[model samples]
Target chain A: MLRDFVKNIGYDDPLEICLSELEALLQYNYRISKRSAALLLLQEDPEMFELVRKNEAERAEKIFSIIEKIKPHYSYPLAYIISERRQREASRIAAAVTTVGKKGSLGIKEALSRAMMNPFIGGPILLAVMYYGLYKFVGNFGAGVVVDFLEDKVFDQHLNPVFIDVVNRFVPYPVLRDLIAGDYGILTLGFRYAFAIVLPIVATFFFAFAIIEDSGYLPRLAMLVDQIFKKIGLSGRAVIPLVLGLGCSTMATMVTRTLPTKRERIIATFLLALAIPCSAQMGVILALLESRPLGLIIWLSVIVGVFMIVGFLASKIMPGELPSFYMEIPPLRFPQPSNVLRKTWSRMKWYFLEVLPLFMLASVLIWVGKITGVFGFLVRLLEHPVRWIGLPSESAVAFLFGFFRRDYGAAGLYDLKTQGLLNGNQLVVACVTLTLFLPCIAQLLMNIKERGMRVGVAMSVFILFFSFGTGWLVYVALNLLGLNL
Target chain B: MVQYDKDDKKQVVPLSELKPGEKGQIAYLQAKGKNQMQKLLSIGVIPGMSVLLVQRFPSYVFKLGHTQFAVDKELASSIHVKPVK
Candidate 1:
């Protein structure tokens, strides 16, 4: 049956002649038939070419020569021509085997799917999803309520004091005690931040994202945004990584590998690093600006404006082929509870495993920096720029923390806000600057790993200056407008 | 309605020109690169297959067999089709 099937699916005359000629020359044993191997070689399958070269040795050159000879027969690539022929055969078989039925009228699901692709309707739908899914569920509940409860009630009330008391009694050295249980200790600061604050916010975000993905709404959202994305040198396929960036930019940076072009990956990476704040940072910012609506609006406007302008400028500066968009639009379906839970749990576990150690390491690094006076020096250096951006010099600590982890920095700002240190204008400027700040150390390493070192370091340098410059502009603009929040 | 040439019976136009609900048979792909051609072919967009334009706004969406796909205007324009009236 296999032999007959293989023979029946022969290509056009010129390709067939070349395939047979190449097949006759191939002496090596392969898992697939020589005909299929010959076809792959003709279509320029690099893996097959390598295998044939390794296995066939001297005969490989002859086989390649036959493949080269067949090239001028068609204007299109052999792969495309072969695929077109196969499709024609497949359609013929499909038409012969299947019976056609009368088309049915549009159902409620179909209408809803259409409405989702409609710009006017989809715009409101997207806003509603973000407002409910991100703002209310992740921000208010996860970051606000859950974080507060865990940090204040659980960790502070029960865990930290017990750990601190036990460490002080058992540990002999003051420095060791500080390292293990004091203010910037692994137990008190690192573990607390990871489990109490970042965990809940990230968990809620993953849960919400899982539901959105399972419902098959992302492709529709991508379709609606393709036109706008093209203006920034990205195709709608980039929406996946960009949305995932909201959950965790480090993970999103890795996801940029799915993009078709280097240019798209670089642009997406830049945007994720620069403008798209992770859920943890966003939740803290939302909480910080909750009281001052005008401050929140200004921060939002500034961040969004920076996102577009930077993306547009990057597209023009980077030279490459424009990204082309193509994606399957799966039917929208109700998300299954079990699937959502499983996805959310797996992502949370992956994130926690990747991040917890880094948080602990950050705590140790901060401790080292404090003892060595490096942290103080860096904070003093950051203070100049912080002051330059019209922020109080004290907020420099948060900017330093921003390098360790983007959310850690935002959480630092949250502490400042609680102490009533930042006024409305200052709060907005800080938020805007911090949101546009460099990606966390983890994402920076990922950027380097995924893109080459030169591009990654280049982007980081650009962001360092651009973020502060944008923040300074926002400060001047806000003051020039003379509108008090 | 089918479009016709003065010299021939069938007139070919880029698939992007088709309005929603119009039907066409793909004539050929004028893809500029091997990557684009591979992507289109992997999705089963090939000569002789019937295509139905489902939506043309924000992006171009079309149906091939039972599956639906969305492509940007650049990709859509590369697909030359003959209208099926």
Candidate 2:
């Protein structure tokens, strides 16, 4: 039946002649039929070409020469010609077998899909999604309510005291005890930050993200943002990784592989490192600025401004083909609760497992740095820049923590906020700087793995200076403008 | 600028020129690269298929059979289509 189908749906004269000539030359047995192999060879499938070259040896050259001879017979590519012929045959077969029904009226789903993509309505809908999904639920409920309960009630009240007591009683050496349960100890700081702070925020974010993804809104969102993305040297397809960057930049950096061009991937990676904040950090920032809405607004504006300006500059400076956009707009539907929950649970599990070890390692490293006094020296060194940005010297600890994990730094800032060390302006400056700061260690490794060592290190170095430069500029501007909030 | 089919002398326009709700039969693709052509072909945007322009702002979205697709203006402009009355 397959042979008959291939024979019946034959190509034009030139292709048919080339196929036979190539088929006759292909003496080695392939997994697929000789005819199919010939067709793929004619289409210039690179893998097939390599396979045939290896298998058929000298015959492969003859096969390729036949393909070259057939190429000039058409203005379009042989692959396009062959595909078009196949589609025509498929359409004919479909028309013969299928009957058409009268098209139905545009249903409520259709209208809603249209409304979701309409520019006038779409902008507001996007804001609503962000406001509710990101701000209210993830920020307030997850970061605010859950983090408070876990950090204060569970860890601070019950878990930490018990763990500290056990370690102090049993552990004989002061160094080992301090390493396990001291100020920057694995149990007190590392486990506490991961389980109490980062976990809740990440869980809520993944849940909300799963719902949005299942609803089929992301493609529409991509369509709506395609023009803006083009300005940044990316196609709308990039929206996936950029949005995923909100969940976790490390994973998003890995996802940048889906982009077609190297240039787009580079630009996407740079922007993710510099501007996009992961959920844990965003959650903490939201909580920090919840009291001062104006501070939140300023932070939002500065980050967004930096995102656009840097992206535009990158696009202009980097030489490459402009990314073309095309995507299937999946119909909008109500997300299934079970599916959403399962997706959220799996993502949360994956994220937690990946982050826990890193957090603990960061704790151990911090402890070592403290014992060696190197951590204090680094903090003191950072204090100059921290002070230059109009933040108090103590906030240097937060900046140092930021290099380990972006959220860790924001959580540090959150600690300072509780101490009332940060005023309104200082709070916004800290948030912006930390949000644009170097990616965490895991993300740095991922960037190197994905983009190679040189580009990864170069991007990190640029981001380190650029983030502080932007922060310093924001501070100077705020002081110059005399805006109290 | 109006484009005319040299063989039939019929007026054809880039798919981007079609207004929302307007219908057209795909005539040919003026793709500049093989990659662009393959992308359009893979998405079922072949010649002879009927397409309905669904939206024209922010991006050009069109319906082919039961599926809807969104393409930026540049990709949309590569597709030449004959308007259906």
Candidate 3:
């Protein structure tokens, strides 16, 4: 039956010629059928090519030459042409063999799916999702409420004093004490930021993201945003990476590999680096701006405007054909609780493992730098840019922390906010700058790994300058307008 | 809907131009790059496959079998198709 099936399915002329020639050449006993091997060869499937090269070394030359000979015969790619032939044959066989069932009218799920893709309805729905899922849940509840509880009641009240006392008594050397339990210590700062501030916010974000993904709503959301994305030279497919950027920009940077073109990847990377804030930063910013709605609005508008303008300019500057997007829209269904929980757990584990060491390293580096006066020097220099953005010079500390992790910077700003150092406008400026600042160290490394070193360095440098420039612009405009929140 | 070379005078239309509820059989794939072609092929959008326009508001969503695809307008336009009754 399998042999008969293979014999009956015919390919196009060029592919057929190549397939027959490959059948004549390949002598080794492949795991798959000769027909399937031929088809795979015709499609230039790399694994098959490598296998052919290894097994049929002498005959591989003729097979490759046949493929080269057939290349000129097709207007479309060989893969496309061959796949089309297979699809046609498959469809014909399917139609012949199957009977039509009664056509069902569009059901509730279909209607809901369609409503979510409709621009008018979907736009408001998206905003609601962002507000409730992102702002209210992750920002207010997780970051504000939970972080406050963890940092104050749990860590500050109980754990920190205990650790400091124990480390002070056991570790006699000042440098070693500072490294383990002092001002810039690993336990006090690094573990505190990761566990107290970042963990809750990231956990909420992953939970929401998992539910959305499982519900099959992402594709519908992508459809709703496709037009706007086109203007930025990205297709709807980029929604995956962009949404993932909200969870963690470092992971999102790696995910950009799914984009089809180099230009799209570069543009996406730059936007992510410059505009999109990760969950922890987002939660902190949202909490900071919670009492001041105007500041929040301004921050939102500035960041969004930058996102669009930068994307538009980058697309225009980088020469590439407009990205083409096509995504399979799975049927909408209630997200399974088990699936959602499993996904969220796995993501939280992955994220915690990835960030724990980085946070520790950052603390150690800061400790070392502070001892050598390097950190103070850098903060003093960064004070110039901080003041330029209309922020207090003390906020320079946060900017220095930002280089290690965006969340760390936001956490520093949170500390400053608690101390009543930042007013409404300065708070907004700081958030804007931090949001648009260079991505975390991991993301920068990922950008280099994925997009190559030159593009990565260039992107980071461009972001560093552009973020401050935008922050300065916002600050000057706010002051010039004399708008007090 | 299948038009051979003998019926050369008939105008060809892009699949993207089809209205919702309309059906079309794929005719030619005028992809500018291998990436475009490969992506379409990955989802079984190839010449001679029948497609139905499901929605076209925010993006173009088409149905092939029970599988539906949401594609950008420009991407859809590259897929030439013939109207089917």
Candidate 4:
């Protein structure tokens, strides 16, 4: 194979021949290739050293000594020198085998790639996408419309009452009825939250995300955000986790494994735990401020501001230089509708399965806590922080619930919003605090899985204090400004 | 760049597969590069970049030169070859 591409060897250096021989030696044993073997020889591969040594005891020993003698003269670790040559051969062949024409893909694709990468212009375009793709389409259309039909019209109004009656009549025991079909019933809160709240919003998000991912919009997004993210010591790779964080921070935490350094991972994980909120939280927030544009601006500004500021501070504290950012930008393809739909469906299925169990488990835990009075005890403990932030005592329950899952807290807030229990200022503080709260159990588990328990616990404590601290500041500032919703 | 490995252990293998505090030889590289060979020859990846799969996972960790990269499997596939050392 190396011979076929060998148009010319420039010079049959002894090292090259030795490597070729080495490759053959390895191949006789059913190995991959010899050229690769030879390259590894030049690189002075430690593993292959034993294999080569055993192949030709005296000569291999002699060659090893010579390699050691000559190794330092070359700046490249021998491995790179070999790979570079192969790459050259590949290039030479590619030049011979392929040709490019003046014409290529154009119109929308090229224009979109450019637009998505440019920061100044791209920022607003991003916001527009957020507004439509996220706020209007997902929040209003999916969660608001689809969810209402499934949760309220179909389940709550029509199905729940029927199920309740059937369970009550069939099950004579009150305690058993409560467990299966009553207030703490799995069929009620668990299924309702999963189907109604989480499903619709996630379905829409996956739809939008698939389109963006397939179109190659994500890398461009990384390019656009590189500067801002760089200030925080993350390169474009951080963008993947950060962007995915919007969909599900737990998943994003796992994806952070793609980043380059322990330092960067720590920083990314910290920022994620503290700042990035998932799709459901984003949607609920948007809906909370949907009728109030100014309020939305304040919320966005605050979150972004905190993101930048905290990121800056963390990068400074962590010991490592910013990694150079480079990512393979796959050619932008028109996002196929079917691909988008399939991706959305698959992700929704994953999200639903993951969340449904957690929701049911959470309901059971809550039920037990309620029965045991532990729920009130925990809520009371949470209320002190709630009061410190100037939110109503009821908001403590949401904060307490936030520990179970971040979105669950948002759902609790949504229930409160219906009762008009919060104002613009209070809402802003609540949103900021909840958004910055320690990541849910899943993300915490991911943090432990990826970064280990020490970093995970440290991150959790940092987030808890930081979130409440931020909330306290926001609450004080709002009051100082005398702006009341 | 070198051609991708045709073997079973595709570049998609997690970086955690690499041993800690160990080095591997660059057996090959396959990328669509013309000057890439020259560039690699210059850098020494020409079958001898001293391919060290450093600090795997938490970042596709690699340490070379005065630099380090958290390389993903996507990048690894572009530069093929068996680990020799």
Candidate 5:
């Protein structure tokens, strides 16, 4: 059977090659038929080789010699020769069996899609997408409108007081009451943050991102950013993780595994940590700066500027050949409402599930910290920097909350916002600092897991100092400019 | 009719519709480039080959058995086939 396969592949009939000497070759200790075993060997088929080696070791040696003689006849590897023969056979059949004609029209839609991938047309188009898909819709409408409805109407007026009453009545201890109903309470803060604050904002973000993804706009975004990305030593491919990091940096850190080179993955992980603000952070920042247009613009410029500058520096430090990039742009399909909804619903559910338990756990830790009076001590310790940044001492808690959950810290700022604690310049400074803050513990753990201890710890420490250092600089710059809210 | 049906399941297509990160098997390679297709062949993309679509964001990363290769989506769309079961 193996011998027959060889004859078929060698493109010759075995019967013609074998003659008077065939009987000797067939003997148990004789050469395993020359062309047949070599062809199977070229196919890298182990089973056939095992059978032939078992039945005729002596014969296999003789066949191996013939294969050695045949080897120099081709410049390429043997596997290439075998596959070229197979593809020729496949193409021949395809030619006979199928018909393709006049090709499909390369009409307006195709040309427009191509135009979108070019840097000149693509850059402004990307800004339009961010403005419409992200800023106006998700940031303003979802975080502003939807969150106001839930947090103000639903939680502030209805849910929180009721939970407060329940805890007050059921619990005898003042400490326990506060643990469940007081500041940083699981029900009052955690659940509220998840539902009232993060929910509407993320739901809208995922909806917008789904449209971009399903339309196959991501690859084009990659192409548009390729040159700028090259300065950071990554091809345009890093755009996927960077884009996704906006949704959740923790997941984006894990997705870094998909990058082609180790250098790209490290650069991506570092950038995600430094500049990309996840949805929760984005929602909070939007709320903070939405009232002050100048503040918002300044904050955006700083983050984007830092992302590029740091990326360029990392690219220079990291040594590797930049992998050439080629990505598929699926035809831009009109985003189906149902598919968009399903994707949004699923992604939101996944995000909520991953965060809910952690939020609950953070509440427990704070409860313990409060019980031990350690929470107060930590707040006092954080107050020096809070004051240094010109933030009110009370803002220390939000900075603490940031370490546990990056977005939760931002939500804490929302609490401060309602109290009118942050003026325009202060809001800008706070937003800048938080955007550069270390990723939440989840994303940090993922960074350590993916990039390992040395790379991971080193990155987090650099970011820790850099976040405060930059925050301090921004604070001074804003103050010196004498801009008042 | 096809669009209506695709609404229910994922918009799964034949190998010719392979995007980055999609997994499929090679049914055939139509048209030419028949000679230089050795890169695909050496990586085990001949007929009856199975591959996992790894990264579809920037390009297509297909892991054929063990070897990983990236190709532009256009080239991927050119390879016609039934998907892996």
Candidate 6:
């Protein structure tokens, strides 16, 4: 396609002379136009320089000297000067071709957008969205009602007994039968947890996220939190990944690649690993602490306090440039129903597919550990730390399960809570510890893959100690204060 | 004459100092950090470009070519502009 307006390549006389001189020296077959290639060369693009070296090997040195020679003529960087000229010409063309509508009166949409960005109004609006969309819709409706129906009615009553009976009748050997339908078996534990518990929570969270995202509210939310984020050594740009971490930290870990600086990415990753709980874990935790408001408050304060402290410390430790953010805030529009539903469906499908096999594998691993007595041994080892955090030794099983998947561990905690095994203070300590625990296997792999082995392993080791260390402190503090509920 | 020009240049302030709803023509962007300069330049915030301040809270939101960009105070200070009459 022909551009409507020509890009005046040389903004000034010296630039024009350099472009022509470099264009004449070009000998290679290039993908883009020679004009564009010459412009890139002037921008000091490394790839273009290599291409020129390979194609125009003899005159590559001359091209280099020309760039060097012109450096003295301009006070600014050559790249900046070139880009500035291009922007000037482009803006001129844009203004010439486009006719804007009546300007003067701010429309309702503008008023609404302004209100959403205003701090006093935006803060309350954010809380309202979280309360209605996340707490009521996702927590109560999806996690509480839907999960109860699926888990208690569908899987527990009908599916498990039938599967166990069938497996018992068909399989003669006890070990093989245990593998198929026993406790911790693939069908009984894995499928039940994945379908009944995690699925509903994840689906509702993704649906809520998609609606907010499509409405163009995410950027406004980013703007609202930019100040708080700056103190953590990140700009508003990091909000996307940080907010998305609540939906799925594994995915959010990968999204950290979008951050501008390595320092910002590392800090964001560490925080995500340490404090953020994905949707399924969050739903279960909310359900666990629903009755104990004080317990819930304590959990929130400790986790948020750790997030801020760790982020600050990490930013200080990792010396790099503070990230400068610039984002195009799209105009707010009513989310199209079809778009929101499609996005929600696609994300749910992707998440379900990624987790299904892993959950199954985890179940099989747990079963194997059980038969070999390794699970018992591991549970015993975890019991010491569990007790140290003021949790009953039985809660050790949940902490063990937590390593496989955060949601699964949270489910284990839920079971113990139902059995009336944990007290309020112990419950609060466990929740805080689990919330600050290491990222799930998927997130760990992602952290290693994104940040490499050294940093990734170091981060997990630090998180492990920090989570337990914080839990111990909370336990002692609770006892000392005599606030045991 | 030189003194008058110097005085006039002093009247131009950093983009960070502009009140919300103000408009300015970018005069000079003296970002000391290389990456910061590159980031701002890539977003078309060069000298001679014009921007309208959208909001000055939590962060500074501005408009250029129908697109709104947000930058914090530190980054905003790096951008120098002469307020539009």
Local error of candidate 6 at A379, Å? 1.3
Q: List all candidate RMSDs to the true structure.
A: 2.7, 2.5, 2.8, 10.7, 11.4, 2.6
* Tens-digit lDDT track of model 1 for A246-361: 99999999999999999999999999999999998998999899888888888888888888888898889889998899999999899999999999999999999988999899
- DockQ of all predictions against the true structure, Cα-based: 0.58, 0.58, 0.70, 0.08, 0.10, 0.56
Error of 6 at A358 (Å): 0.7
Query: lDDT tens digits, residues A44-78, model 3?
Result: 78888999999997888888888888888875567
Clashes of each: 0, 0, 0, 39, 7, 0
lDDT of 2 by residue, A20-43 (tens): 788889888888898998888877
What's the C-alpha lDDT at position A315 in model 5?
87
lDDT of each: 0.90, 0.91, 0.87, 0.72, 0.75, 0.87
Top model number, TM-score? 2
DockQ: the better of candidates 5 and 6? 6
lDDT of 5 by residue, A144-252 (tens): 8999999999999999999999999999998888778888888998888889988888888888888898887887677667656877888777888889889889888
Candidate 6 — what's its lDDT?
0.87
Query: How would you class the docking of model 1?
Result: medium
